[model samples]
Target: MKVVYLPGPKSPLEIREIQDPQPGADQILIAIHYAGLNHRDLWMKLGQYGGKKEDLVLGSDGSGIVKEVGSAVDKKWIGKKVFVHAAQDWGPDKNAQGKQFTILGNPRQGTFAEYLAIEAQYVYEIPAYLDLKNAAAIPLAGVTAFRALFTRARLKPGQKVLIRGVGAGTALFALQFAIAENCAVYVTSGQDHKIDQAIALGAKGGVNYKNENWSTTLQEMAGQFDVIVDSAAGSEFGKLIELCNPGGTIVNFGGTAGAITNITAQRIYWKQLNILGTTMGNNEDFQNMLGFLERKKLEPIIDKVFPMSHAEDAFKRMEKSEQFGKILLEIKS
Candidate 1:
């Protein structure tokens, strides 16, 4: 198998030949066809996120076909095309492979390889309606957005939601789901151009956070939003708190603009607001998200596609912070 692996933190990705993994009793081997590149993988590569030091393969989302199934696994799934779950639930055994939970590309080996072995149950059949290339883009970001809005916040149709960043993968989906539910959606982007992009994606309108006194402009639309979702919470964290209506919820999946920021206690207490944190969701959430995509035929915004051999270029493009959507690695079949 050919793999692009990080031998250590802050190290360059080394694409080379590696031994293929054998499936365990409840696991299966998959021939990876594509891998989705995310900023999270870069964070892990830089040791900013906690991942194992043992030659990590950096990717979270992937689409692949089953090559072989282990004993005790469903034979029906053999030869089926599937999307893989990035999360691993390996228990506390020092020698245990794949013991770490829900970690696909971080502390564990990821989908940058030509092949991978994972729990049979973690392999899900890609919706027949979806393109295989698109299925690779769905695992982490899709599941996270679905879990936060639907499970944690319970956003209802016709409600209002404000997103802190417009270009982020999850934020994009938040806007789409809001549109699907008939909710009024607003977003903020530091780059003035993303506001128009957000509008095209069905957001009612967006505010330009880069403009001087944009905070006051946003405040003008008072009591407008019932929910707020953000990955960029630098100085805007306080302003985002102010964007929400009373009893509104703020969903935080990540912080792209430095994690630590000041949020006034009065904002949380006086408004009776909620700040909910979400990570990659469970299997059920992934399944439900797939169902939604299958039914609605939703597509995650695609920023660019790089060949698997050009993984470094893909990472560089994502780090530029200018992409309009998900960056993908297009693997040769």
Candidate 2:
């Protein structure tokens, strides 16, 4: 097997030949076709992500064919096209993840390789509407967006929604899901072109947050949002609170900018806003996400695909925030 291995923090990614892995009793071996990159992978490369970092294969999203199954698994799975659920041991809780939960590509071997051995339970057959390339982009970002929008925010059709920092994969998913549900969707981005791209994808309108009065401009353009899906939480977070309609909900999943600061307590209390936090979801969320995609016939927006050998360039693109959608590694045909 040839794996993209990270030697250490700030180290260059190397493609190395290593021994193939055998599946455990409840596992299956997959001949990986493609892998998707996330901000988590970039953090892992910098040794900033929590958990063991060195000598790791870093990827959370993947799609491939089931090449072999362990003795306890059904042989019928062979040759099945599947995508791996990125999180493991999400346990019985539908509301939250359990103690044993861990994402792929950290302490555990991941999908950035020619093959991967994952628990059979975590592998789901790809929908007939999707190809392996797009399927590889959905597991992590899709589930997070689904859980944040539907599970945490309880967004409904006809409601007005805002997807903050709209260019990332998860934000784009939220925008698509909101539109599919018949909601009026808006977006914000630092780049003007990204805002236009969102508008092309069914967003009602958007504003570049780089402007000093971006939130005010958005409020005038689209009124107040009933629900806001956000990933970047920092100095600008307080502005989001002001943009929400009374009794509106804000569901946040990441703090990429930095610590949230200087939020006015009176605004939250007076408006009766709900501020909820979420992470990579449980099994139910993953299944629901897949079902939603299948039903809506949604396809992920792929910004670029690089060969496994050019993994460094892929990471560089992500590091520079140059990608407008999911970045993928072509692991195989």
Candidate 3:
């Protein structure tokens, strides 16, 4: 098996030939066809995220065909095309992950390889309309977006929603799902072209946050949003608070822009705003996300696809924040 893994702390991801894994009694061995890249993988490469320092395959999303099934697993799964869930051991809590929770691409092997041996319960059949390449793009970002909007924020049809940062995979998925729900979706981006691209993808409109008075301009253009989904929560996070409608919900999945220093507690209480934090979704969220995509026949927005040999370039694209959607690596047949 060929794998792209981190060799040590602060190490560059490298491709190496490694032994293939066999499935356990309740596991399935998948021949991975595609793997999706996320910012978490880049953070792991830079020793920022807490992934294992040695022998770690660094990817969270993948789609493939089940080549073999373990003794305890039903044989029907063999030869089925499926996508692997990003989280493991989500435990019994639908509201939050339990103590045993662990995301893929860390201490355990992940999808950046030709083969993956994952727990049977974590595998889901790919939707009829999705090929392996696009199915690989959905697991991490799709579920995160689903949980953030529908689960955490409880977004409703016809509500006004704003997603901060329009180009990343998760944000793009949020925009798509919001459109599917018939919400009025707006977005912010540092690049004008990104904002324009977002509008083409069914956004009502968007603004470039690089403008000096972007927050004010956004307010004038879209008014206060009923829901705000953010990944970047730096000093500018206060602007998100200002953009929210009274009783609005704001969900944060990551703080890519660093720590927030300016959100006012008074405004939150005065407006009765709901500020929530969410990470990867639970099993139910994953199932619902896939079902929604299948029912809607939604295809993931793929920015670019790189071969496994060029996985480092894919990481570079993510580091530069240059992609408009999920960046994928073609692993193997």
**TM-score, per-candidate, Cα-based:** 0.92, 0.99, 0.98
What local lDDT does model 2 show for residue 206?
A: 95
- Quantify all predictions' global Cα lDDT against the true fold: 0.79, 0.93, 0.92
State the local distance difference test value for candidate 3. Answer: 0.92
- lDDT (tens digit, per residue) of candidate 2 on 286-325: 9999889989999999999999999999999989888899
Ranking by lDDT: 2, 3, 1
What is candidate 1's local distance difference test score?
Answer: 0.79
lDDT of 3 at 125: 94
Per-residue lDDT of candidate 3, residues 1-333 (tens digit):
999978876777788999999999999999999999999888888778764767678899999999999999999998999999989999888999999899988888889999999999899999888899999999999999999999999989999999999998999999999999999999999999999999999998989988899999999998999999999989999889889999999999998889999778999899998999999999899999988897888999999999999998998898888999999999984
Q: List the residue pairs that clash in candidate 2.
A: none
Which candidate should be chosen as best, given lDDT against the real structure?
A: 2
TM-score for predicted model 1 compared with the true structure: 0.92
Please state the error at residue 274 of candidate 3 in Å.
0.4
| Candidate 1 lDDT, 1-333, residue by residue in tens | 888877877777778887889989999888888888877887877677764665787788888888998998988878899888885673444222243456787666788888888887678898877777888887888887888888788889889888777886777887777788788888888787888999888887777877887767876763557888877667668877777788989888887788656878997899999988877777677788878777787887888888888888888777777788888887656
Candidate 2: minimum summed lDDT over ten consecutive residues — where? Answer: 90-99
Q: After superposition, which runs of candidate 3 have C-alpha atoms over 4 Å from their true positions?
A: none
